[model samples]
Target: MERSFNINSPAEFESISLQIELKNINEFTREMNLNISWQALEPDFNASMKRFGKKVKIPGFRPGKIPRDRLLQQFQPNIEAQFMDDNIQKYYLNGLQEKELVPVNQAEISDVHFHFGEHFSFTAKFEVEPEIVLPKMKRKTLDVQRMKFISDQQDMDVAVDQLRKAHARIETVEDGAQEKDFILCDLQKLDDSGVPIIGKKFEKQLLKVGDGSFTDEQKEKLVGLKPGETARINLPDDREKTSSSPYELMVINVEREILPEVDTDFVKLVNPDLDSVEGFRDEVQNKIGENFDSRSQQSFERELTDAMITKVDPGAPPSMVDNYLSN
Candidate 1:
């Protein structure tokens, strides 16, 4: 690439013309032309000196005492020319870079001259991004599975349990062990050395004896147990250990929970919008349906995004990646 410059006034302004010749071996050659007319260097230098003279301090005088000619002689031409060169180079480079043009070689500067109070001109040369021929892609289709939401018996049971719990009240019971009761107790484990392990103690813990959560052995241990009653629970052989050692837990104190019966008042307490159990159940069903629909749409959108990206299969250049990383 070759560039030419015609600086009419070295002290005032410059006029530049740029011609770009791009040659790609065994490919194509492209040419581009640009013109720049920057303001004269002398005027800018004089203006800079005038501004500086107003603030510059001289040894023989106070601040703003320096003469314009003296200030120009000291700093004007070099400083003003440097500033103009920086701006002009930035402007030219930005235009080329925006057009994705890369110069394979240094741009040659020619016809360089500068005159006072005249326009500056310059020329630049560069290569551009190569034309890409995309390969034809065969369209292929595949069947995909679609998911739908359906309510099950377990879902109904969970809804009913939540409603029942919401309406239930805690009462002091003086009777025997019952189902769905929270038993508060403390637990201890024996280390391999047969000593009581003291970490992670349970204080006034609540355990619902039934509600289909306890194993048959656990249920048998809890049955007929009262407050302050302590029982030893055998740890399962396959139980996951907290540490890398085996430990055995000894249950202490079994306090049972007493769940209240489900009624219209309970339904009203749980659901402010519903006065009856049936209305609350209807609301739960609607909520479940709405949640399921939202999840289904999200899944569909994700699948569609994957499919679109697969179809496009865009290619990126190394230089483009480097530029992105630099930014």
Candidate 2:
């Protein structure tokens, strides 16, 4: 790409001209090789070091009093490395402006090389917006299942039951564990060989059954377990941070949950906004309808999105999405 530099060039840009070679990778991507010259960078490099010397602590000399020659000898390499990083983007941007290329995502930079009093150059790959219109396309009429949320008498009764259960009294059950039971157990972390790792145990951890919070393996071993029973649980390696680890759980005690009666008194306690059970049931029905309406809207949006995606040009590179996510 040959274009004149219109933007005011920076003082460190000692090059009278910049060379930018743009190679088309595809309809939406390009590889740009930019060559920048360093006519006089030593002056700026010295000034930057002088400012840094005031802040950098040295053993022999007080801060800001290090001799220029010694300072240059000791920190010159470090300063050069920083200068390349600090100025590479500045030069790349300048070249991009002159050539009028607007990249859609972060450019992949490579082959960077620079020398004092010499030229600095690098190559960068960029994903650009392809200049093409989405062609007219059609698909069989999408059969989005029209969601209907009709909370009848049975649904209202179920909602009331759940509300009552949420305010249930917690009691200790000596007759083994059941659903909605809180178990007090210790989780001991283990190595790959199923041996307990010392100092990695979690003690007195409280877990609620039927909540789907514990791993399926742990829940399966725990549901029928009585007090004083120990279950060796092998957790799955599905978590992002934790792998499959063995745990020896000594069930200290089991607390069974007893739900309150879904009567006038319980309805008054849970639903203070509504005075009677009839009003509370109506509110639950409205909430269910609202949820179904929201889901229908989302489904319609997805249909439109799928249609537009099918209309896009086949040349649209898959890396475009991957590149955007990485950036």
Candidate 3:
């Protein structure tokens, strides 16, 4: 939506003219077309020159001693550019005030035209909070599902196991790599002729077997690989195709985490407040229950929001979505 209008000048400036056009790019974005007659800017330009004259240095004369005509002759373009840069936002705000608009973001100024004796015109694009109108409810009450949190002994066990692994000690293993083992290897991409490609070799790279981004097939190949042993594995192509390419992986060392036993000493080490394994298990269970409750509540809220959005279908600003996804 766009509309052309003229902003009324103050009674003091009878010769000044302001032409404004308001354009709506979306529900929350707007562009303002602003044009001001040369009569409106001439007085400000003269005042700006006086301010600049007091500080600007000249070779033949002391500060503030240069004539206005001489200064204009020497630096008219620079002075005009500087004056515009310094006061463009002031005029933009004046236009916003005249139109009774509240911008949510900084205005993006573009298509600026400034002629010393003609006019000064520019376009300013900015975002604003959308006006929200609540629709009349079809029913007196809304029926939303309430989600409940549930946990079991198995869940507690898994959570405890994760905590144990998180604090586990790491040691180099001499035997073959197994599940949950880290393999330090040299991975070199192979060409069609079964030779290493130049500049495609990566050394001392650490890969965790049976976990992370590796596929099941990739994990299987690394399971029985021992130090000094090499294997060829097919990995997904970098070009995002279904085809695979072979790479040579030579294991330099095998590393595994040594988890502590679930004893009184271990429980004390994990938490000073808990001296017994039973107490530690109870704390872990409570934490797991809290986590489950949080997840359940979030899921419920998400579903409810989706349902409401489906009913209303309000427009979401693209900038807000981009900011959310980036963060």
Give a tens-digit lDDT track for model 1, residues 1-327: 123332221233233333333334323223333333444244444554456566657678666767656665675655455435544454355435544665543343433333334454444443334455645655555234456667776887787787666555576564646665556666555666657677844455566675443558766776666666666554443446333433332334444434455667766677667888778778878877788888888787777656655655555444455667889
In model 1, which range of ten residues has the least summed lDDT? Answer: 1-10
RMSD of each: 12.5, 7.8, 7.0
lDDT of 3 by residue, 127-154 (tens): 7766766677877335578788899989
lDDT of 1: 0.53
Ranking by TM-score: 3, 2, 1
Model 3 TM-score is 0.68
* C-alpha RMSD of candidate 2: 7.8
Clashing pairs in 3: none
Stretches > 4 Å off in candidate 2? 1-21, 35-79, 93-106, 111-113, 129-132, 136-162, 173-180, 183-252, 314-318, 321-327
User: What shift in Å separates residue 217 of candidate 2 from its native position after superposition?
Assistant: 15
The local lDDT score (0 to 100) that residue 289 gets in candidate 3 is 85
Q: TM-score of each candidate?
A: 0.43, 0.61, 0.68
Residue 312 lDDT in model 1? 56
Clashing pairs in 2: none
